[model samples]
Target: MTSTTLRGVTIDYDDLGPPAGLPVLLVHGHPFDRTLWAPQARALTGAGHRVVTPDLRGYGRSGVTPGKVLLADFADDLAALLDHLGIERAVVGGVSMGGQIAMEFQLRHPRRVRALVLSDTSAAAETDEGKRFRNRLADRLLAEGMDGYAYEVVDKMLADYNVTAMPDVAARVLEMMCATDPRGAAAALRGRAERPDYREVLAAVEAPVLIAVGADDAYTPVAEAEAIHRLVPHATLAVIEKAGHLPGAEQPERFNAALLEFLAAQV
Candidate 1:
């Protein structure tokens, strides 16, 4: 329920971890919200790092803008959120589309980023198949409505981990995804599906970077993680065994351990 004015948009966020601890910002991907980072946040906090999870524009309790918004706006909003919280610099991590945002944010605001984590994300432009996949899915959403969209999204992202093996965690993620504004979700994807190439930016990143992906992730495959690692000057890639696209929820123990260890090296 907490909110802050970031470039006229009221950014909604849940600030966890200890106030005195090193700040870590967690950004969730499409069709989900701040809650996606709950498990990771709790574990990071227990390890003495502050965690801040925000509901991106048009997701969860955050207000939706009238039309589609570019990912740059999301990055700007993140900067404002950090400024509002009086955090000068901190570790930033993102999953899926959120990882893209985190990458761009680090590129534009290097001084504000102490470290970077890209979880199950790629730096390449969307393939034609990717665009077609999104278009077909959008068509389905227009035809079947939010209920159908929710089912389809959950099936794609959470089925491999949350549903079959981790029902409780899956349910929590579904709750957040289903609660989102379907129109907002579609619009976010519509605008984001065409993001530019980030390889050069990735190579230019001087901050310590950690590229991670689930071994079982079918969406953003492990190859994407390797690709990112190849581009970054000294980025490290860690694979979480037996996990899916949403490693933060499916394999949080491993994800948190890798994240904490990488962050510790930065200190």
Candidate 2:
């Protein structure tokens, strides 16, 4: 892992594979670090692609901000990271909140995105109830820390079957969440509550898109993925079975296969 200062914050990241290989940037979701993409990173790098995974601000080894951190802020950090690495463009991908960040990146830096991969995420703006819930959750996190919340959501993050069948993945997911700084998590939640609707932004995308979601994902179900597909008519959609929100980690083989095929034929 390497560390760099972008936008006055220290960002920790891993740049793997040959420097000349086609670049693929994968972002992790809320409360998780770059390790969420560990399996995918290894697979992509082995397939001769340069994989970049970063621990977003307040997650993993990255610096934390006490206040809110907007999706646009996250997108700018990524753009700055790419500029620092001297990369002109890359296949930008993310999971859940990371997927939303990817959308923000596409909206802000269209020329720097070669293609897009959005997994288990939505483009709709937060509703009034959602805003209230997010703010309340943020307050809860700040007040109580992450243990209880992490434990409660672990099963939802992965399918209940995954907790029993793939203990290692379950443990990793929980660890990432439990270890996250509450201030950062709260800040992210607060910012996410104010995110704009991206339906039209997605509809205007000229770059190739790949939408992958777990069939059992309760957080962002296959219906949400279908909605994204509808917006981006030319996108390739893959629904991984026996997986939930974090399908790339829960069902790495299937997820990697879909990703590899997309990169080979589309990007």
Candidate 3:
């Protein structure tokens, strides 16, 4: 793990694999940390790709900001990280909120993107109801802390089978959520509520794209992935069976296989 100051915050990230290998930056979703991509990091590193996974501003060991944090803020932090590492370009990817951040990054720094990997994310703007809900959740988190919210959404975060059968994965997910700072998480929620629509952003992408999702994801289902695929006609879509929101963790082998194949053929 390495720490660097970017945009007035300390960002914590892991730099794995050989220095000369192709760089792959993987971003974790809301309420989760870089550990969410541990399996993928190992697999990609073994396949001779450099994998950089960062605990976005408030999630893991990184510094936290108490108020709202725009997706642009997160995107800029990633750009700064690449600059810090002297990386001119990379295959940038993310899951859920991270995926949105990846899109924002591509929008802001198109030349720095080699390819895209968007997993279980949407390209649409936040609905009015969603904004209200997110604001309410943010208030709840700031008032109550993470325990209740963590336990409440843990099951929803992964497939029911994962919660029941994959105890270790379930525990890790829960632990990451429970340990997150409420102030940071709340700030993120508020920021995410104001996110811009990215449908046009998706249509403008020129890089090779890989869109993967869990077949059973309730939050961002297969249809959402299909929508993204349609926007980027050249994208390769991979739907992992028996997984939910976090397929990369619920079904790491399958997720890693899809990712490795995409990197080999596309980027």
lDDT of each: 0.83, 0.95, 0.95
Q: Give the TM-score of candidate 1.
A: 0.93
Model 3 TM-score, 2 decimals: 0.99
Q: What stretches of model 2 exceed 4 Å from their correct place?
A: none
Question: How would the candidate models be sorted by lDDT, starting from the highest?
Answer: 2, 3, 1
lDDT score at residue 157, model 2, on the 0-100 scale:
97
Mark the regions of model 1 whose C-alpha exceeds 4 Å error after superposition.
Answer: 139-143, 159-162
Q: How do all models score by TM-score? A: 0.93, 0.99, 0.99
| Worst 10 contiguous positions by lDDT, candidate 3 | 153-162
Which stretches of model 3 miss by more than 4 angstroms? none
Residue-level error in angstroms, candidate 3, position 150: 0.9
Give the CA lDDT, 0 to 100, for residue 121 in model 3. 97
lDDT (tens digit, per residue) of candidate 1 on 205-260: 88899999988788888888988988899788999987888887888889888988
Report the Cα lDDT for residue 202, model 3.
Answer: 87
Cα displacement (Å) at residue 220, model 3: 0.4
Q: Write candidate 3's Cα lDDT for 1-267 as tens digits.
A: 999999899999999999999999999998999999999999999999999999999899999999999999999999999999999999999999999999999999999999999999999999999999999999999999999999998777998778989999999999999999998999999999999999898898889999999999989999999989999956999999999999999999999999999999754
